[model samples]
Target: MPTTEITHALLAPGESELIEVAGNRIRIIVANPTLLVCDYSAAPHFPGPPLHVHPGFDETYIVLEGRLEVTVAEERRELAPSAAAYVSGSVPHTFDNPGAERARFLSICSPGGFEDFFRAMATGDREAIVGVSERFGYEAVKTRG
Candidate 1:
């Protein structure tokens, strides 16, 4: 078996690549073939993307500040600072800022490349977004209000 090389990166405060998705500002910390890490900040009462599932990787979130309402499958919960949540592959999940202040969190996705979809979305490349979503086996599910 072959071994994968380890990489190192250091980003100062506010130094990461920033992108806007669905009105949320995402700061990309690191994106490699094996992992994608990002910081997400959203305004108060901001609802994130519709329920979605990743067929290829698991996603984890760490709440850094404020509060977030997270929904996974049939369960919903509110996470505060220093809280964490995990959504496995094929599980439908979504999150939103329910607090009165801005919400911030860090997200990590395993087996990387999802950042491509984010970049495409930020650039408003509809075709690329659709293609990347399909290539990465991501599907959105409708949610009832």
Candidate 2:
């Protein structure tokens, strides 16, 4: 059997690549071909992107502080600290910070690389975000007639 290389990272506090889009903050903790982890903080009325889906990636969101309102397809819930939600690649999902306090959460994406999108988001260009999102197979949900 052949040996496979492993990827690893050790980032000190405040050492991650931080990106702020709109009023939310995304700190990229680690990004590799197999995994992408980010620490995200959102203010109330989050202004999250539209319900979207990643055709080639699986994502998980875990709340660390305050309250988060997560919607996965037709299911919606308010999650408190320590709560988590798993979203399949093809599912339409989005989230918001419904409470008055800032909400902190972790976002883990498999087949890692949404970091590129976050980086583009830092440019504060909607067109760039759309382009990058498309390149990564992450897009807004389509409506059915």
- Cα lDDT listed for each candidate: 0.88, 0.85
Model 1, range 13-91, lDDT digits (tens) per residue?
A: 8888898877788898988889999898987889877898978889999999999999999999999999999999698
**Against the hidden reference, what TM-scores do the models get?**
0.90, 0.88
Q: Write the per-residue lDDT of candidate 2 for residues 5-92, one digit (tens) a residue.
A: 6657899998888898878889999888789999999977775678888887899999999999888999889999999999997999
TM-score attained by model 2: 0.88
What's the TM for model 1?
Answer: 0.90
Model 1 alpha-carbon drift over 4 Å, by segment: 1-6
Worst 10 residues of 2 by lDDT: 136-145
